[model samples]
Structures are given as C-alpha cells and as structure tokens.
Target: MQNDWEWFNNNPEIKKLMQHTATQGYYFILYYMYYVSSASSVYAGLAFGAPIMDMILPLNETREKIPSFPTNYGIDGEKYFILLGIHGFIVNAMAMAWLWTTDAFIIMMVYHCSSLFNIVGVLLQQLNMKNCNYDEQYEKKIITEAIIVHKYAIEFAEFIEKSVTKVYGFIFMVNMIMMSITGFYAVLNFEKRKSEAIRMALFTVSQGIHLFLNTIPSQCIINSSESVFHAVYNCKWDELSIKSKNLLNIMLTRSSRPYTLTAGKFYPVNFENFGNIIKTSLSYLTVLNSMQ
Candidate 1:
C-alpha cells in the first residue's frame, strides 16, 4: 500500500490521513467484536437448548455424522455445556476475526483510494495557478509534473478496481442478503425472544453501515475526478504557446471522463446505486413479510 503511493511519502497531510484511516479501521474491528459476541451468545443458546432444530448453523449433519463434542446431555449435562461454551467461543472468535480483517482491508482500500484521487485534484489545481508569473519553461515543467501525477492516479485507480472490486462486490451482495434474511427472521421471532431479535437488529445495522461506508468513498472518487475538469479548464490557456494549450486540452479531455469505482462492473458503488440496493432489498423484505 505504501509503495503504491510512494510519491506522497514526504507529504505530511497524506501521511496523516493514512494513519487516521488505519486507526479508524482498527476501531471498526473493535466495535464489530461487540456485535459478534452478542450474536454468538444467541447462537450458542440455540445450539445447546435446541440442537435438533439446527436454526443457528447447519451443524445437524456434522453433529449426527461426527462424534463431536459431548452431546450426550443426559449422561454428561454440565460437561456438555462447558465444552459447548468453549466451542462456541472459539468458533465465534474465529468467524469474527475473519470478518473484522476483511472489513479493515476494505476500509483501507476505499478510504485511501478516495484520498489519493482527491490529492490528484489538488495537484491539478496547482498546475493552473494564476498567480505564478513563471516563464514558459517553468510553466511547462509544472504541467509535466501534474501530468505525471495524474497518470499515476489513474493507474492506482485501475489497480484498486481490478484487485478489490470483485471481492468487495461479492461481499456486498452476501451482506445484503444476510441483512434481509436476518431482518425478516428477527421480525418474525420478535415477540418470542426480544433480546435475540435485538441482536439481529444490530447485525442488520452493522451490515448497512459497512455497505454505506464503502459506498461513500466510491462517490468521493467520482466527485474528485469530475473536479479535475474545472481545475484543468481554469488554466490560462490563451497565454501559453499552442503546444502548452494542446497539452492542457488533453488533460481536460481525460478529466471529462468520470473515473469511478464499481463492484463487478455491474453495480457502481455510489450514492445513487446504494439507494437502489436499499430499495431493492426493502422490496424483497416486503415480499418476505407478506409470505410470513
């Protein structure tokens, strides 16, 4: 990650943002632990009290096939509960660890990618400084530097899309489906066990937050890329030689094309698309409610 943006190593502001983002990602993991613990307690209760129902996890087949942890409740009730508690803790911890790691990675990629793109806009603005009374040679040098930075920014954007988009996309879809199903079940079982339903509510909210957090940064990338057009157009093109004007025009043309981060190239990760996802999920939830 550091190597991807090595050009900005000396930049204090960029460094600060990167540090803040990393710290924030870790904080998210800590917050997620609370939810995982709550959900785990609920699942453990189901596993112990209603082993035949298999509501919490698909463990019925495995439980029946494998002589797993002590399930002979009549023979060893307390021992079974003790081992089950330990098993639940371990399983929950491992699942949450995997989830939290993925969340942190996505947060890092989205936040840093957005920041890097915005930094490119700042560089573009620098290229069109009206106050500078430099000679043509100096102006050309400034333009060249800006062009190099802009190219790197585009390359980094491509790298992020190709590497992160599909994985993030799949995760997003799965989370959406889970949120909907969990929400439906929570509503259906609310009166039976309010506490358990509340845990499901928390899970649904966290999933929503994860989706929104990723979506906002993607919109930031789009907005920053669009801003480049204004930055390039504001240059004093008439004052420069035809060659300089031509170069600025090329930059303007490039900036005019919106650069966006997408999920599988099917769902554009922006505010508009996010709203659509919510709307579609709610529609499904409505159908589920009617069936129930």
Candidate 2:
C-alpha cells in the first residue's frame, strides 16, 4: 500500500494536491464526526431510554415507531417494550460508525481522483508550452516525452474511473436519498425535537458537501481536459518542423477527446448534476411537506 501510494505521489502536482486535500478531508471527517455524535446521542437515548422514559416523560404518539427500538417477544406480534433497547443502540452505533468511516474513504477517493486529473491537466499544459529547439532530434525527444506523459496520465485517470465508477454511483444515489429524507424530517419535526431536527439538518448539509466535493473536482477535470486543446492551439507550433508539427497535431487530436469521470457511465459528475440532485431533493421535500 505504501509502495502504491509512493507511485501515485511521484508527480509533484499530485503530491501537492494530496497534501492540500488531506487537510480538507480532515475537516470533512471532523464535521461528519460532529453530526454522527449528535445524531447517535439522540438515537442512543431514544433506543435505550425510550421504554423507561415513556413511563415518565411519555413518547409522542405521532412520532415513528420501530424507530422506538421495541423487541416483540410474543408470537402474536405483541411488543415486550422491555428496556432492552441495547440491541437498537448497538445497531445504530455500528451503522453510524460504518457511515463515518465510509465517509472518510469516499472523501479520500474523491481527492485521489481529483489529484490525478489535476496532474494530467498540468502535464498537458506543460506539453503545450514546452519550448522547441532548432535541433530536430532534441525537439522530437521532448515532444515524444510529453506525449508519453499525456498518455500515461490519461491511462491513469481511466483506470481510476473504471475502478470507482460504480462506487461513485452508489455514493451519489445514497447521499442524495439521505439528504432528501434527512431534510424532510428535519424540516417537518423542527418544533417537536429541535436538537434532533438540527442534527438531521447537519447530516443533510454534510451529505451535500460530500457530493459537492466529488462533483466539483470532476467538473474541474472535465474543464481542464478541454483546456488542453486550447493550450495546444495557442502554442508556438508555427516554429516547429513538419515532423514535429505532425506529432503535435496527433497529440492535439488525442487531447481533443479529453477524459471524463462518470458515475457508472450513466451520469457524469458535474455541478449541473449536483444542482439537479439538490433541486430534486427539495422537490421531494416539498411534496412530503404538502402531504403532512
């Protein structure tokens, strides 16, 4: 794993990006930790303390059950309602822990992918701006190296995309669903449980930030990939020999296609898709509100 990381970080651009994103990733983890802590506290309280508390404080009837963490002991579907809410507590705690870890992994993946794309973009830009000498062999060697670098970068991005596309799709769908459901509950129950509502709101926002972090970098890569063509077009290509010009034309043609990171190939990650997710979630929330 260390060897693989070393290989990935071999590029200066990639190393710098990794360092920058590590700090951001840490912030995201911390934010998620707060949300998880707040949410799990409420869940733990309700899951374990509800039955006992119900005898005193009493639970609101309108609130959802099953969420009450009741264990039905009788065969006739009768709830024992024993204070054995430990099972619910355990399950909730485990799931929340899993989610927190998963969030960190997802954040890391996004940063890694973004860094690779950024490095590729830098390579393309450098290639376009590289000075060509009058020495034919020297110019050829430099341009050839640039081409190899560009191809290497493209292949690396493609590999990363293929390996993570399905994962990205899953994360996207799950995050959006969580956002919608959490936002709906947060807004609907603001009066009943202000702290719970606030926790849900924070969860929703964290999910949004997670999605944004992935999509924005994807959009940046897409834009950067396209920018390569412009870079090539504006370069000092007129000074090159016919052979060099032909090689550059080939590179330009290849770069024109660009690289894209998609979510299972069904959806491309971008700001536009991110907006659509938010709008769709809001629409669902609106409908749910109207029903309530």
**lDDT, candidates in the order shown:** 0.68, 0.67
* Stretches of model 2 off by over 4 angstroms after superposition: 1-133
TM-score of 2: 0.65
Candidate 2 lDDT tens digits, 1-292: 2443587577776577667756665776687678776667665565333445556777566233333343554533225333345556677788878877865665565555445444544543543455554466765776776576566557766775787689888989888788888999999879987756766786688678767866754665576566656656765676667887898798789878767678887888888899998898878888888888
lDDT of 1 by residue, 1-292 (tens): 6784576778776566556655655665566656556655555544454344445666636332111232554555544654655665676667767876776666566556656555655555554566556567776776787778677777767777787788778977997788789789788878986656766676677677767766765776687677667778876676677777888888888988877788887777888888887777778778898998
Residue clash pairs of candidate 1: none
lDDT of 1 at 19: 68
What lDDT is reached at residue 127 by model 2?
38
Per-prediction tally of clashes: 0, 0
lDDT of 1 at 138: 70
